[model samples]
Target: MKKLLLGSVCGLGLAAGPALAADLGVPVRAAPVAVVVPGFSWTGFYVGANAGYGGGKFDYPFNAFQRQLQAEAPAIESRLDGRLGLTSGGFILGGQLGYLYQFDNRLVAGVEADFQWSGIEGRLSGTGTLTGTGTLPGTFSLDAGSQVRWFGTLRARLGYAWDRALLYATGGLAYGQVRSHADISAANGGTPIPGLTGGVATSHTRWGWTVGAGLEYALTQNWSFKTEYLYVDLGTSNVLSSAVDDPGNGFSAGASMKVTTRFHTVRAGINYRF
Candidate 1:
């Protein structure tokens, strides 16, 4: 009976030792796996403000204008000295609304609309010298002034984001209200002769287009700051005159004046993502 008990204990000990050894095999640890993606996100609406530099090309068509004066009266000839390329500097404050879509490959695309309040005032002036031989045999001089049409654009922005920063370009339709003013004066016999001197101020809301580029840096999870430059080309429009008292004939002739303007502006702005 004793020998049988001892044999049973020895067999149980051997079985337990093998079970412990098997449990300790390999010392396994779970391998690390991907759990999250890294990329840019634009899942909300944003707004901001910015300030910077603005410049561009400008032109006014005054060639036919002077010819018209030459044809009207042989003694009347007008020439413009500086009538275009007026540099401007100002500030723009506005907001943006848009939706962002991110591709699976980390490519982000968004469509946004922005409106700006502009302080952009551009000025151009000209000097005209008229010679009267039939009636007066002396040279008379006159001066001209400029006008500013203040307006902004509704644009769409397309950008590429690298982590927290975005490099982008924007373009779309632009519209604004422009105000123009001009002065015409003359001199006779070395004394100021107030012949025909007045100003025409007209405000018109015109439509055009704009294009630009910019860079933005993220300030927070839902906010960003940006500095951008835009070039806006508002084509020519005509300015007409209503019936009024005429200086020479008590009759007013309707004249169509052409206006063409361009601009380059930069601004720093902040945006909040919704």
Candidate 2:
């Protein structure tokens, strides 16, 4: 009887153990996952393309020429006042390459070079008869024009960067090609003077300086967009004009004139940073 009771208790304990194990749910472990963090930086080299409009002043000082002609006939100087100066505007397209460095304090600095093609030009003319006293009784006509074919600049940039955007000022050396033309003619008693007509067309390269400001924003890790404004001054150029009689009987004269160029450009561009 004692052996049978011990056997029955052992069997009951075994059945209860299985039920307890089933009541307590087992926990399963899952695979590990990756966490990603993003960082922003502006230190890099970049290349870009740009397009915009440029407009500015064309200053042609013909006072010396007017004075010379006035000495021969004072009436000619009156017609010259309204024909010497003008404004020019046109399209500009170009590309640029540059490198930049950023500081922990959010200050940024860079150097850039760019070239552009331009189609800017202007023209003006005036004509009248010298009818007053102390002047030759003759009709005179004056014409002038100026055109800028292309330009480029090497510039230094300084800015403050906020996250992915920058505000900056830039200035540096500038160079370009300019073409200028001028003409003057006189007729006395309805007959053209033999050597009293002169014209000059000059094409040359000039160097100057430029200053401006811009805003740039980074669209992605490697791409950015920008808008900028620049003021450029290409120093003066001089052209000579001469008129002489064919038979040595007409008067011989020469005029010296100077041209100063200045323009403002606004452009938008996209850049690839590396």
Which one wins on TM-score?
2
Structure candidate 2, residue pairs in collision = 195-244
Please list all clashing residue pairs in model 1, or write none if there are none. 44-274, 45-274, 48-270, 49-269, 49-270, 50-268, 51-268, 54-264, 55-264, 149-178
Query: Which stretches in model 2 have alpha-carbon errors above 4 Å?
Result: 1-38, 64-83, 129-137, 193-196, 243-252
What is model 2's C-alpha RMSD?
6.8
TM-score of candidate 2 relative to the true fold: 0.76
Model 2 per-residue lDDT tens digits across residues 1-274: 9999999999999989867776886555679999886556778999999999998988877532221233454434222332266889999999999999998998999999999999888887887664434454577777888888999999999999998999999999999999998886766677764444678899979999999999999999999999999999999897544544233432343345668889999999999999
**Candidate 1 residue-wise lDDT, 174-229, digit = tens:** 87766655444434455433333344665667788889898888877888888888
TM-scores, all models, native as reference: 0.68, 0.76
- In model 2, state the lDDT of residue 108: 93
